[model samples]
Target: MPKQITRAYEERLLRIRIMSHTGDKIHIKLPLDFVKRMVKNNALDFLSGKDDIMDSQKLLNLLINAFDYNLTGEIAYLERNNGDIIRLIID
Candidate 1:
């Protein structure tokens, strides 16, 4: 890691930016080496459906999954429960 990348730059660099008509903005970023590992683990398909910003649930899941945490149990539980699950998902 020669010439270390500053936190600000590193943070911005991971973002996946997109521009849209009607003055809408969309930003997506993942941690360093996220895609590489997911690729190696054969989980890159999870990155799909990201371009569809209209799918709020999908977008929320992708953002949380970015952290590589274990939320499978919670996810399964939510499948049984109801009400704007995004709160529980993100929490």
Candidate 2:
């Protein structure tokens, strides 16, 4: 019999948490499609040559920029160790 391969369902959305050394944190959820689109749009500049490198912070900034432009819906929360919490929702 031939070997069979199975494909898993593609993830459509993702949630991530970022924290600073000062104990400040932010939670973000975004659609994978939005990230793909951003990467595609910037591929020319970011992926022009094999020697080019794109860091995670740069990608994070791109996502933040997309949120700023209202390109997609997002939910964000900011938490501080000093008992302060802030919530933001954008669509």
Candidate 3:
């Protein structure tokens, strides 16, 4: 049998932001459960680019582990030379 992991005391949210040099910005907030469901249903297929591929299973595992480990805060941040920014946060 596989070992079961304990869930965190509180639920978390995933926050994503995309900003363009032209002052355009997009922000998205999703509950963890919704993200897990989306990953299971392959609804995040757009995450893969022409030459880059993201494994759904791996992404699911990461999400599971995030809660298991009680991880919170910014997990990814990127800034381009053109002054655009992207950020991924677990809160």
Candidate 4:
């Protein structure tokens, strides 16, 4: 039988900056483990395609729409489980 796995405490990771040509910038911080999981799950593959690439503007708009209300001026910690999760601290 497989052993049971438990969720560990979430930790802070890296911050990504989204800059626009109008000199506006939005900062988003994500957990390291979460990012690794995303890569492993090919969550970012759409952005890496050469032929049918996702538009940068559309991606940015989606991000902003999803995280606009969660913006923070400073870094913050979030509670998360070991299951697939994506938490963003946008500013």
Candidate 5:
């Protein structure tokens, strides 16, 4: 039988959740491979120091690369003045 190979990027997942004051909620989950592709495709270009996205390009890159370090758990948590909450996790 041929030996099977496992990719590091395939073992990681990125999760995001947002809650609004009006009880609205949103959640997203992405595999690291997809995240990598998105980064390569510049899908995150809007996060590059943009005032609305909060200049998160570097932070996002860091999180995406974190798979190399075998990191998991909450990466970020934010609470807005309007009773909104955002959470980012890696699993």
Candidate 6:
């Protein structure tokens, strides 16, 4: 694990809905600024389920060299610099 800097957007953005033992619900929503930032950074395509999504040369390099990669068959990249890390465990 790496030292994670608590991003401001982490508090305002990305949310998760979880159910407690009491059958309560947790609602979470991603921050607008964070989403905008990611789009500006060119990582926003991952937010949308677009298979034909093609990354530019720079984004590719960023994904490979300066970023952490934990790809298992599918390439799932979440913004590490943003609020609440969201992991959509798909079956």
Best by the TM-score measure = 5
- Supply candidate 2's per-residue lDDT for 39: 58
Model 6 regions more than 4 Å off: 1-28, 47-91
List, residue by residue over 1-91, the lDDT tens digit for candidate 6: 9764444423433333444445555554555446446656877554343442434444444433322232222223343332323332211
- lDDT of every model, 2 decimals: 0.39, 0.49, 0.70, 0.44, 0.72, 0.40
Prediction 3 global C-alpha lDDT:
0.70
Which candidate do you rate higher for TM-score, 3 or 6? Answer: 3
Clash-forming residue pairs, model 1: none
Going through the candidates in the order shown, the clash numbers are 0, 0, 0, 0, 0, 7
**RMSD over all Cα atoms, model 4:** 16.1
lDDT (0-100) at residue 38 of candidate 2?
Answer: 59
For model 2 the TM-score comes to 0.35
TM-score per model over all chains: 0.30, 0.35, 0.63, 0.37, 0.70, 0.23
Better TM-score candidate (1, 6): 1
lDDT of 5 by residue, 1-91 (tens): 9764444656767787888789999898889778778887778553343335455776776766675676777888877677878787887
> Can you write out model 4's per-residue Cα lDDT over 2-41, one digit (the tens) per residue?
7643333244344565444455656666665565566556
| Residue lDDT tens for model 2, 41-62 | 6642421335334354464565
Worst 10 residues of 4 by lDDT: 77-86
Ranking by lDDT: 5, 3, 2, 4, 6, 1
Tell me model 4's lDDT, rounded to 2 decimals.
Answer: 0.44
Q: Roughly what TM-score does model 1 have, to 2 decimal places?
A: 0.30
What lDDT, from 0 to 1, does candidate 1 have? 0.39
Q: Which ten residues in a row have the lowest lDDT in candidate 6?
A: 66-75
